[model samples]
Target: MTLAFTCKKCDTRNIYKISRVAYYQGIVICTCSGCQSRHLIADNKGLLDFPEFGRNIEDYMESQGESVQRLVLSNTGVSTQDSSTRLSPDDSGNES
Candidate 1:
């Protein structure tokens, strides 16, 4: 539940708990009036406001052994001149 704001101009990050005004709403301006100058450079958002991406808990449960098999196949493919092995990063922070 950490509330944070990225200065749109300078990219300076700010964190807040509460404010006198309601400027902390989604995609709204930072409390600091000076931040307005950076409006085009950064976005103010709470960490939770960012989109949830990639695999989820269900995917993890399904992928356990299959994912490792993919890696082994990919390693074998890499030895070939043209490997059709293109994989994306997984939720565990490794190549899939």
Candidate 2:
């Protein structure tokens, strides 16, 4: 099955099949490292929950060294910016 992961912060979200761990799994970080306001304000216990479909960020954070945090944060920022730009204004409100 395909799985999706989204950051509680910035917005970098991605999808991968169950077996894609080596290359495509959603790596989670537990040190409250997400780059979004949501993540910054979120409790550690709940950070992984709102993203809904991600692997346990803490597992990867705990196991991996600190080398990848920058990369992850970059991706998250891109995702958040891209998502905000693509949002569709509710048609119920008005179409412009």
Candidate 3:
């Protein structure tokens, strides 16, 4: 999975790529490539560390005055804008 967000401190755009395992872990810590600031990206979990910012990529970018663009890409070179395709760790790779 790839995430593109802007740093609040440096205003630099950061692109982060992670594996499916990391994505399903539900917590991602991205380091700003420009200012080297550590940011915590998680879902529903409150602040726990001393990161410069603690929020999902969307919220963080919104706070930084950047519009959120959500896109999902699959291995078959297919892309979609469906947010309901969210995957969980327990997903069995089968459609019900």
Candidate 4:
């Protein structure tokens, strides 16, 4: 699924292609290609509770106009450094 949101650091519009599996995970970390700043995307009740997450993001994107940067989420995990690096469920950055 595709997600669109504005970067808080750079104010640049970003579009991310997220995997459906990510919804099951605890947290999702998104990096803005424009400023290389990282943004955390998460749902307190968990993404499973909100099936419309993708749709909501799409709506926000449409309302914001054009998106300048695009990123794709890998099946294994979100790559913060290299392709070999994968963030497991334990590394979701959530202590809870």
Task: Name the top lDDT candidate.
Answer: 3
Looking at model 4, report the run of 10 residues with the lowest lDDT sum.
51-60
* Clashing pairs for predicted structure model 3, backbone only: none
Summed backbone clashes in each candidate are 3, 2, 0, 0
Judged by TM-score, which candidate is best?
3
Q: lDDT tens digits, residues 1-96, model 2?
A: 333456645666754444334224443222323553222211234434455433443334445542222111242232232343322334246757
* CA lDDT, every model vs. true structure: 0.36, 0.37, 0.67, 0.60
**lDDT tens readout by residue for model 3, 1-96:** 777777879999998787656554466788999999987775435546534344465666677786766776565333347655555434657776
TM-score of 1: 0.23
Off by over 4 Å in 2: 20-96
Off by over 4 Å in 1: 19-29, 33-96
Q: What TM-score do all the candidates reach, one by one?
A: 0.23, 0.21, 0.52, 0.41
lDDT of 4 by residue, 1-96 (tens): 676777878889998877766634445668998999976555434444554444334333455684434343666556544355556666878898
Model 3's TM-score against the true structure: 0.52
- Cα RMSD, model 2: 14.6
Q: Which stretches of candidate 3 lie over 4 Å from their true place?
A: 43-55, 59-67, 74-96
For candidate 1, the per-residue lDDT at 20 reads: 25
Query: Per-residue lDDT tens digits of candidate 1, residues 1-96?
Result: 224445546776776443323332333333545454522111234333323311221233344432211222243232222444544334346655
- Measured over all alpha carbons after superposition, the RMSD of each candidate to the real structure, in angstroms, is 16.7, 14.6, 9.7, 13.0
